[model samples]
Target: MSDNYSIARYLISQLRPGLQLGETVLSPDGKVLLYAGTILTEKHIEKLSYYNCEGVRVRELQSGVGMGFDSNQQRKRGNAEPEELIVSHEYYEADMAATVSEQETEFAGIYGNVVKDLKRCFTIVRLEKHLDCELLQSIVDALLTLSERGIGATALLHTATRSEDYLFHHSVNVGILANIIGNLSGAFKPSQQRNLILAGILHDIGKLEIPVHVLYKKGSLDEDELHMVRQHPAIAFKFFRRFKEIPESVRLGVLQHHERDDGSGYPLQTAGAKNHPIAKVLGIADVYDAMTSKKVYGEEVSPFAALDTIQADSFSGKFSPKYSTPFLHELCQTLIGRYVTLNDGSTGQLVFWNRSGKETCLIRFSDGQVIDIMNQNKLKVIKLVC
Candidate 1:
């Protein structure tokens, strides 16, 4: 591991299930293999052994630490100040040498609940050809509701770690994102909005047909595996094509989301106005979420970087400007004043967005120095930080 990593080292045997990763673990080639805050599972441990890695790094304990909220104490205190509950790198780094504390256990328990509920919902989808709309809606509503309570979308997404069962978690994210975009664009009626959410939920229904060993593999995929994965959209389209209950917009979303404007995507080389508008939005949402979320192999880019890539794709004729322009503009507005982890491992505030520039942004560091990130081609914003 690099010396700049923000984590405490623990022996391989010392790491047990339920421990959260303090920072992202990288491959020998520097790609992010696992994201920070991901909960440990047996599969993860096995993979660690497969790579012959040494000890692992876990999140620093926060007992009696400043800026690290003591949830139990806060509950007894009635109402705590904003500063009292906020978690910060200063406090965590200061207490890195401290022993594992009880607060993380409680935090993990809360996250575990979200994961379990999500698993239940996905299992229902697998058994039935269609999702239990009410159950699925309830879970997504809870997530959105939490976001409304000032937790933000990333916080709610974090509750369901990216370490296990990515397909289901991804479906839930895309569903939430699709609903947000649809509602914000004022492009759909209330009924239309609900259907759009359902479409996002079932967009990857074909992936379930893929084998478990292949679906959850750790390393790079072989050509045959890649070919199988690419067939998912067509498989999904076939599955629900004759189901009268499924909406046309939804069926179109599942079938055409992977299609590109320039006729570059798989299954069908769909181009221009041929792709459905809803699918275009789904494609953007899908890419945005996947880029930000932890992955099985590739490195996760920061929100701004993801948007930049999407913007480049739009300019390259891979995505429609009709859908990508408004959506990216709206999303970028939400990112102003947010903190992000830089490629050089420094944390900075996103001060501005360059709408006309080749580079994406200008960021302000803690030391009162501002850097235009676009000038450095190799730099990447790792993730958005609260």
Candidate 2:
């Protein structure tokens, strides 16, 4: 392969069958160069003996049987037979011949700044209610600006991570995702969008008062511990009540985010007729984030799976049908064209969105192969690889 070859050009090559190796496979500096060719047998290794290349190595590979180079390694190391051989280049660049380098750079930079601003906003909220309302409003304005420009705010928010401040990051993610859902459903105006964002940012503020051990406990909560957990909504409600100037809509969203439309939620079991519209939106966003986030007890579910679960429950009368159908459909559409990593360690692009079945997507690999997630039983979507 040439240095000028674009990453998109190589995507198809990675899907090719047999042992195909590049000279600069996985190199950091991106200066390594090598040829790509198939390995017929161990005897064929001698053919390259005349080509003196330093740091040369041979590895067995299989195609269509698994996902990427990493998947091949795992299968091969686990007593699986070698079905192909792949050569790699000496160096692999991070950007790897991207078509729109400038655009990518700008997008990454903006995303980074947004994450930073979200963290700052949470910190101010934690310290006191003295945060500059205008500053908080400005952050919301910035997000809307990027969203209007066609950036997937939900995906961008999903990609950001925080190790030490899990609550803050989680809250921001919930807000961004809720705002995206509201915008997609055509239910929110500019003012409502800002309110939703603010509500999302503060939805779990009550959790701050809980003991860290209880919040981060690895095992299931006992009855007494669960009692404490249930008090968070009330704690949040009381805290917000102290701020009389805060909009009632924002406060109500924080208090009622956990309330279900079927009257099964905690504190107040408000049914569809009783639950506020903002609260319903917040509830959907809250559970979606929780189920998709890594926790002590279990790994996060795939975004597609989470959406499926919500849709299933909605149809069964567990959630409000008014908001659930459109929200799930829009979310699935937003995820089309994104790349994801499967539970089996395969990397592919999500090319289709199907809302009717357990398998909801068509994931295409580099080798002109497509995995019908709706039909494949062995593989399931695990997460969106940002």
Query: What are the per-residue Cα lDDT tens digits for candidate 2 across 1-386?
Result: 23322222133223332333322222233322222222222322333333333333222223223222222222211122332211122212221232123334454576567667766765676677444566667666665554542224455455554444667667766777667666766677867888887787778878877888988887788998898988888888887766665588888888888888778887777777677777888888888888877555456778878887888778777677666677776566556545677766656656566666454456655443555665655567788764
User: In model 1, which range of ten residues has the least summed lDDT?
Assistant: 65-74
Q: How do the residues 1-386 of candidate 1 rate in per-residue lDDT, one tens digit apiece?
A: 12233456877777765455665565565433444444455656676777667877775433311111111321221133544323345633433323223333343454455546767766765786565556656665554432232212443354344745677667777766777766666677766766666777778888878888887777878999989988888888887765667788888888988999999987788887898878877888799888887767556667777877999999999987776787776566445545667655566656556576564566654333455666666556777764
What is the number of backbone collisions in each predicted candidate, taken in the order shown? 0, 22
RMSD of each: 16.4, 12.0
lDDT of 1 at 242: 56
List TM-score per model, in order. 0.64, 0.70
Q: State the lDDT at 212 in candidate 1.
A: 81
lDDT for model 2 comes to 0.59
Off by over 4 Å in 1: 1-88, 91-118, 125-134, 137-161, 241-243, 357-360, 375-380
The CA lDDT at 166 in model 2 is 68
Worst 10 residues of 2 by lDDT: 86-95
